[model samples]
Target chain A: MFKDIADVRGKLGQQQYIASEEIGTVVYLAHSLCKPILAEGPAGVGKTELAKAWALSTGMPLIRLQCYEGLDESKALYEWEYAKQMLYTQLLRDTLRNVLGDVNSLAEAASRLAQEEDVFFSENFLLPRPLLTALTSDEPVVLLIDEIDRADVEFEAFLLEVLSDFQVSVPELGTIHAKHQPMVLLTSNNTRELSEALKRRCLYLHIDYPSQDAELEIVRLKVPDLKPALAQQAVAVVHQLRNMDLRKMPSISETLDWARALVALNASSIDEKTLTNTLTVLLKYETDVQKARRMMGGGDDGGRHGRYNR
Target chain B: MDNRVVEFIRGLRAAGVRVSLAESVDAMHAVESLGITNKEVFRSSLRATLVKEHDDFAAFEELFPLYFGSGGPPLQSAMDDMSPEEQEMMQMALSALSGRMQQLLDWLSSGEGPSKEELEEMARRAGVEWANSPQEGRWVTRRMLQQMGFAQLEEQMQQLYEKLQEMGMSQEAIEKLMGVVEANREALAEQVAQRVGQQIAEQRANRPEDLHGSDLMHKPLQSLTEEDANQLRKEVQRLVMQMRSRAALRRKRGNKGKFDPKSTIRANLRNGGVPIELKFKKKKLKPSLVLICDVSTSMRAVAEFMLRLTYELQDQVARARSFAFNSDMQEISVTLSGRRAADAVTQVLYDIPPGSYATDLGNSLNTFSKKFMDAVDGRTTVVILGDGRNNHNSPRIDLMKDLQRRAKRLVWFNPEPQRQWGTGDSDMLEYYPVCDSVSVVRNLAQLATAVDRLLTER
Candidate 1:
């Protein structure tokens, strides 16, 4: 069941192969010991897809928590339904009045009001957020915390407490422990370095770009209708483009898009003509496209006539 | 499998392997799909997959075999086909050709060796801004020239010099071109050099630049420009080289004892000319260092240089271990394992993840004792460096005893200074204790004094 990352590597071309020895070893170790795997890499390098694939393989739903700059305890953990609390308060007023029947004192009324407030804000009124939901859910889940680097350092430190114990602490509810710990995955783009404390809690793996041959295989797999020659040509063009100092390098997804764009234009080959019209699929930024066009000796009019001008 | 190979190579490159895009494409078509998993297969696969540059092949071969761990009997069969003398000659030729080819490729990529029109076009691009002010134009031109990688630029300059000679250009013209190229090359190198030297200087100058935590705290803040930075770097390089040369010369000259009247009288009392006691002062300098580096992103490039400086000091300095800090601190002396200073620097900088926290100078001092003070003794001197912007983190003063108790002298190298110390979150005012000396370190010149102080202590 555990395919060696190298053996499986032989099945795909260099660029399309998603797993590395480092990544595979961590995956194998995570599965064996049931440790949470934390995959950190730059965006567009496929961190979320790996977790999704694992969930599919295990037949479990992938539970995602998209992290952002302002993610806080209430949003990530749990919060009470305030309207429900008010409705419950109204029902309790009528019931308690008949049951207790006038213990009429100002001090007693004040004390009762404070007691009711505590009851209203208790655990039963709380709504479970992704963390609590994943913990309490009946089925096994793959918990993915995407773009974790965007979150603040304090949040990372806070996450450490929950990640380490598979339990979270709430001021009103105390600690809610996980019945069965979900497979936790945290990804980052290395915007900032992670703390050693946070790193110690999970196995680490870094994902990077694919090689040309691997990329070629990926193109073939994703676009079977395209000619092998055209696919190879598009891969070659992408490879060349990667060498240039562009703002955003074409990703594997972009490579497929470029190929599809080439195919859709009814081009049998990736000649200079098709390249000019299809350059948009390869490069997103206007500045990047202009620079690439200049490099290829093309006109600003987006004409493909300049292919092989060099 | 073919597609998979391409993806895997790209992935490895993305992980910081420095694989070129062109090679990745070449590798894809070069190797047919194969189930080969052995070292030989993998090696061949990589060879098929990678575009081999001549000089790089040796390093590639070494790394390639090692990556797979015992890949078949090393493939030296290609060498076995020729006579020993012939093989040696061929190898030398290949090395030369490869080196030259790489140099040519680098020169071409750098926008040097462009056609005259292309050169004019590049100058015109700079000219657009030059229209506003001649000085700004010059600056733009210098920046454009600096945009090319230093290694690439230097190689291009060398090639240009060679071509000029081949064309029999006037000696004056050749020298002029060399000067321009050298100046431009120096500017590029200075960008990184000034950045590195500033930290060393800031530490020496005993000043840290203060920046309050606010929306207006511009980074690369009031820092040295690339040109000024390069000059400082050259100054540092020249100083070190001069020191090394002077030391060597001193050793060659042997002992030249100066006359001492007291010693002479004492010797005469003991029966002199006939027993004249000659006094000679020892010239050997004692060397010890304490490097405290800020590893925040703003200070990252500077931190790398300090790491390199640490590695360089390993052989020269008597006792040293470098520490890195952001919100926390870590001693990275263990990471400096290799021969090359740059290699050791990269290994440590890339491997050690700096934690997310503002500069906590006071806490870092407390941490030093727990992590490093035991290893230090009375002979060592301290060198503390930071922007002095403490970010209001807890300042633990009692722990400053590590510097007070163990160090022969504490040198707090503040990148900012007395003027900026108490302005913001900078707690430099609180760190006056336990410091035997403090300097405003902002350039290479300041580091010279710090180096001298460390050397003279012995």
Candidate 2:
């Protein structure tokens, strides 16, 4: 229900998510065009948060499908509740005998029983997963397919149908159409190249690590109680760490965690001692920590630093 | 405006960004709905709809402006900001210019560059359609600029500035007008050059003789330039994706495990113990690999791509330990894990600077067994990528033989052609019988096939 790109930004701000203009514009277009937005970026950026915030801002429910390897239609779309159907069939055996009573010929009894077969395959035995629920919802919702790259290639191909048409086919129920089209966002970590077929159907947004000013604003916004000067220095250091070729780049989530940790430790500003103590909070690897220390002009005796720097 | 967007997409395609028809239509719809009221929104709309790949974004950013920038500078009519008397002075100075110069003056003041059709016609007149490659685009663009008298226009603009002062225009007025003219001329030149070059590229892209990515496949790996190397870097991802889909279609046994009847029965027990839902045995625990690559200048291109594939498809392998050697050897698995593969290759090479240009694969293997013997186990596939020339150094097949005894599969990739094997002090034939498989990989296609065979044959 956002009126414009500015309106999207304003509404998302109400949800405490600071969106860049590019993100706002893309989200607005995806809404207007009824297209899925394929957001690709590094890990721990606010890709999943954007969908959550959009759902909150719009007062729609959030329907999430976490895709992974071996994710198939039975898991993602809809599954037949075979156990329930079997229980019902067992209970209805006497009724079936009564219905088939007084039929003389075997063929006649078989024909008579055939008329009642739709009972078990009806909507009562259908279990709708996230994809089906999103399509068949009576009201519009936000559908987030997270870590789609982790899904097998076949699963990605299967999604193309649901994405392009906003409809899905259930063998018993026929093709189900969306009463209200959901605003869908699919996020990828760029672990692999998505097929051209899938990319062609959706609007694309690449959310890289935020710029320094943006990250500072994000940290200050997300963690309100931190002192402004401390937040500034923390963001500055995280930015420096991001610039380094670490095994794992410290993302915005890590920055926020670092800030919260700094506050919890009662530290007001970053110093050599504090940085070394909290280094584990910012970086994951010992090699990465040593490299950061070396870059901080804090030389260590380990030979790993030599192999890394060279 | 849509015309400009269309040209922009074409220019993007010519620049090797794959903008499909569906994406192009989406871009158009995005633009049409956003309205061009805000240039930033318009740009974002186009980018989000048209560009999908992270790698293509750089191309999109580079070409977006060339198609969408105004022919002239943004300031419209520097004289309009002046007092009425100064405007009259400007009109008088403009009246003295003749024909082309006058038209050029008027166009510059308008801030709308020459029309697209006009640029197209000029490019055609310059015979730029004959240009069949992006590398040749710059040359043809220069020819088009020469034909358009762009060089003379710069000189004439200077003359016009002097004439304005002589005509008694105020110094401030003269300065403003001159600055606008110079900026406008520069913008105009850039506009023409980019458009002409775009046309040449489109011409080349449309031709059937040189398919976009296929050309790189046949070219010898040794002859690949740095630009070609970057292109190959991007292409490697596509190749892998293609192979993945193909493997899925064929149910490639190398990467995927076979049907699990036991697991299928166990899983389907929930449904009357029937086999309506069959399950696949999960792909065998991903096989670990040890890659020994030659980081010598001669093998740099092949080795970089090999690392690129590994970095991209890292999860496919359980654990990979990489070592780079020309003369001295260093374990680079940790180094490669620090960054993306493209930069990782350069980092590894920088870390282990080539020694004497001497390739001692034998000695490197000796060191590998001596210090890092624990890196290899029966589950590891040991792949050594080099020419096997060894620069006449000791070809200690004994070391290779010893390593082979401890490893699962010993595979050697010789980028040298089959005819050249054992031509010099190759040491290829000496180590050949001891190895399980030796693949002759002379070009990208061969390399891809060899890698495919090695990875899938297991």
Candidate 3:
């Protein structure tokens, strides 16, 4: 999928995804070794985005499976398409009667029906979910399993087989291995500890919040219309806010959104009045807004205006 | 497998990073595929194969350099570059040294002190640098032994001592020289190890990322920075989620609570009156909780975190009443439940006025019992968070026992260490027996574990 680490880095950069060298190296290795990459990090650090960017860079279709509580094989791997199976049974009722026309005894009829059961349980009735689709696709895909930690432990354990061997076993059809060997990426928010068996099957990568310089670069790329100085100042303010004892620090995406919000307002720089007016764009919790307001020396309109004028 | 890679894997295992046999084999293949020419690629490849969890990344990073660092200073022959005058002076000093010491020095300079190859192997395994020459190699061996600590050295030193005594040294003379030999060995070892460390560091110096995840779990809450606090918050949230699932699983396994005959019969009417699927009565009762927390300065840090836990777990309990107190008690359940967890904690801190800087548990209990006596019932579980310190005042032990009698269970969580429970002004010793359970919660992990136990028990 990638010639080398530099190639991976360059391609990701072209897709507007700034990856660290560690990330590029891991991606390169995962591609060469045909192993899945398990990306763990706090929310909004671009764990899912990395997979999306990889898809865009490689021109491969992206298959995503968003995990949640009680997620199971039927939802993630494959299902039988029960409604389709029912319709098929109804449609095939006449054909079944014709095929069994010569049968007289009940045991003979049952034996004939059993022999024809494979038709109903075959691929025609299989509804391929993300995992199966990724495996059975004609072209390699970028398979993203987002927030996998939210899934139940049993579901995670079930995933271990498919991830390690790139194959899924169906009771009726036996095991079906991958044809294209898709590039798989699993992301976790660390909501729960993932099982060791599942984690050992993949390459581990952790994505943390970007540093100041990196965040500035991201802001410039994401909100190209914003002034350089204004973007720099906004990132600086966000950094300061993160250091504060707030409920939720502004993530990188929030920083970009705040920069865009400032640009839309035609704000030249991060003044206290402007920041106070638009703090909600960055901080979701009211408590954080109040804390930021206090840290900026209160929400007094006159004080903020006087300081900005000077 | 590359010996260095195997050694690196051993180091990783020692640092608590698990590497299974399969993973080690895969890591070897990955290294071969990626090639070791590029340090970044090799490191990432090995890491991707060996490290399974996010937290283990730090251990991998720390161990990588110690194992794969470029060869240390080139090996040199002993006395090859030394001037004749220096060599003569060294020999003269060796002659003046004790016979046992001289023999040991000869063993060292002749490249036979405890086997240089074995010492080098030990150094490589321990991630220490081996000296280049025989003379320096002796110092490296001694340094490595010292680094292994006195207990380990003592065992090896005993064998060496026995060997020296067999070489015809007097008991008194041997005892006299033993202390000097040990002291000199330690000093030379320290100096040589420092120099070797500097040389390796100059070649390539990299420090792993700072402590995170489990490393921060047991640290004191008061010392936690914003980053550490955020990490702890995430961990606590994860624990709460896990506990919720565990409780749900337990409920499912114990689903034979009460037979719902009506529902069962209605459902089985289609199956010719054969009750194929059984249904059980669903319990409608929710657990009630009463949390009494100490908001004094000493307990405030952990108190806030505990309050956060209670807020997150409000759904698990039917009715949760939170009370914060220092010298006086005030119900803050409304504030805690009305807002986001972080906001609620901050708001509660702001809403409650700071009481006197002393913990008056007796007075607080008296206030709670007087005003909220009716709230305690057979279904309610009361949790008290404090150091059990009473400022040397009356503990009102009778009231505690009475409350325990009324409530289903009374659990106490003390942030102070267990050894300090009865010392100072703490009334823990007197009040401990009255409560159903007493847990010492000094950090987030213990706090989470205690809460998990509480949830599961219910």
Candidate 4:
């Protein structure tokens, strides 16, 4: 457990995640209150990374559930091991016949088979997925539901019921409650609006683009071999690009990658030619690269491309 | 539950942040666990519990300080820094001022204005209870401040500064005092505004639900402001979800797909392959769409909104390819992917500057047929969103016929009234024969109805 908000920052810092005061405070309260934290922002701002850092800092086993469209309960929560159950029934067919061999009436024999139905539906045949694993774990864990916005709205309904109570009901084995309620962190890219009912049960944390100084620190920490001045220049350029209203703003990890790429190339300065060569590392979209080059001025070869030529 | 936190939640709600009762309860729980001794934690506790959307983060940041910050200016008073002899001289100079100025100086020097009750009374007297909206709250606060003599109070502070100079106080001392006085006056004005805002929020919280949906659906798209557009974006998202759930229920009721042997065997596992109960697959009813929109100035709002709705419902459709044009066309399917529809609209609208709008649907259709002819197939439903005023250009009826031939069906949503069709340059009459359906979609209700027909008639 965190001693205080600052302790959260300190512990997470040791794990190499530089948390802002808001992030630290939210993490602290999430631990104390035992509410899920719905961390949302633009991609690559470390919404997922923060969850990882928290789990590491707290020494909790991390269980991640990656969400996509049409995500459903059988995949996320639990699934019946039908093949295993079927194989068991086949192997035990003669043994079952022996138990029912002395039955006089057909009705009594059917009842005897009915009494043994629980053997297949029991916990041995229930394969626990991330949600059920996190809930049923003996020790506390950090359940990270990554990119939850990508999941269908119906999946959110399944979640709304499960999150309100840290328990899952299997018809044969009854309700399996959490021995230690796992700290849940759900990250979103803000691509789709999450239902308000789900938000109501969770603590909401919005992580935007970090401050310039923070980015500088992050770059230096991640790519220690990079020159200090080049790191500063890279952070400054990222800040400038963030305000250009481009399709995709460069995220923190992109900045770090740029720094690392610059180091790998043994580059000491961030000049126009160097930036053009390394721009692809920062921006994924060809249009975004052109826009960044256009904004950087001195419209070089990258900016002269016909489609987005200014 | 803390009263102050409750009041802050009310302020957030009235500010349109939509903090629900469950969120407020969570906020109180967070605050209790975190404790209020650390102000940053306290703030984060409230924010994490109450604000769930990035759009509301700014409002929370703005209102948090106003609710939780200490009631004092950031400036320090010169009197605190002054020697006893100099302070006495300054005191005498302020005391020499008479009536309202003297009383004002006394309050400013004390670093406290009228108490909460007094401020509330003044705002009540300013009719803040009658101020229903935040804009009206601003008006009431301004009036309340003026009535409280804040305007004259500025002049009084100026007079005091002159008196200090006349009384032989140092120039530096006088400047320092001025900073404190200005800061106090600004703080006093803010207090009035905050109190008025709170009262209005209190009144709003009592009256309940937001005014949404019905009127907005009937209101024409062109008249909606940016805020209304944002609200409508949420409405569209909700509409898609509602329509999806309803579709799901309908499917669950009667619709069945291919037979599944595995599920049938599993159902009759107890009876050794004696299949009594059977199972059928859930039908996948997703449709593919091709949306071509005229984003000229007159049709821009309608086009933007139509594209926004299409993008929100993209999940329901197996595939959606969108294009925007004024005098030229660009395939925006890539631009609109993996982004919020509202944000994507801004980018698309930015790329296609409204300044060069010529409403040349004829030219755009030619561009589409030449460059994007492969996008349409036998199963595609090509929907055109426009007002159909083609700026006196060629109608290009041959291209429209070709598109209708390639597509499963071509539907047109013309916002212009039927009487206005082909009156001047509109190609609606010419394009009507080629289209499978032409629906008037001036407002959201009509637009939704048209879209519903497009989906259901499939």
Candidates in order have lDDT scores of 0.58, 0.80, 0.76, 0.81
TM-score of chain B of each: 0.45, 0.74, 0.52, 0.80
Compared with the true structure, the alpha-carbon lDDT of candidate 4 equals 0.81
Q: Each model's DockQ?
A: 0.01, 0.59, 0.36, 0.50
Q: How many angstroms is residue A42 displaced in model 3 relative to the true structure, after the best TM-score fit?
A: 1.8
Ten residues in sequence with the least summed lDDT for candidate 1 chain B: B70-79
Rank by TM-score, highest first.
4, 2, 3, 1
- Writing each residue's lDDT as its tens digit, candidate 4 over B1-458 gives 38988888887876678788888888888888888988877887888899888878887886776667664343234467778877788778767887656766766665657777877777878888788766898999898877667778867877787887887888987787788877877777776777676566668767666557888888888889766776776677677767766654554454588888999888878656766567887666545789887788877667778777656555456577888888899988877876776677777888787754477888999999999988899888998888788888898889999999999999998888898988877778888889998999887788778877877776
lDDT of 1 by residue, B1-458 (tens): 56545544543432223356654643443333323454444454454235222223444453342233331221112233334554343334334434545433333323234344544454455443233222353454454454433435556556655654655555565565455445434443333222222222223223332322221112222364553333344344445545544543444344444556665566555331343345554444444677777666545645654554455455344467778777677886655632234455766666556655566767777778777876567767666666666678776766765566677777776656479877767767777665777776554555556556555544
Tens-digit per-residue lDDT, B92-150, candidate 3 = 55565556556555433332243446544556654444332234545554555554353
Best by DockQ: 2
Query: Against the correct fold, how does model 4 do in TM-score?
Result: 0.86
Model 1 lDDT per residue over A1-310, tens place: 3454454333322334355454554554455445576676545666787777666655578889998865877888887766566567567877768644676887887787777667777877889889888888887788998888677556777888778788887777678788877888888765444554565556556566778887787778778889998888888888888876566678878888878877788898766778888899879889778878777754364344334221
Q: Best lDDT goes to which candidate?
A: 4
Q: Of 2 and 4, which scores higher on DockQ?
A: 2
Q: Put down candidate 3 lDDT per residue, A209-285, tens digits, no spaces.
A: 88999999999998999989888888998898877666677888888888888888999877778988999999999
lDDT of 2 at B353: 68
Better model by TM-score, 1 or 2? Answer: 2
RMSD vs true structure, all candidates: 28.5, 5.1, 12.7, 4.5
lDDT of 2 by residue, B1-458 (tens): 78778877877776668789988888888888889988889889999998888777887776666566553344355656877876776667667877666667766755666677887887887777777555666777787667656667777777777887786777877777778777876777677766765565456445553444788988877788776776776677677777677655555444446788998889878777867777776665456788888877666657666556555444345477878788867887777663545566677767766655577777787898899889889988888878787778888888888889988999988888887888777778888899999988777788789878866776
Query: Sorted on lDDT, highest at the top, how do the candidates line up?
Result: 4, 2, 3, 1
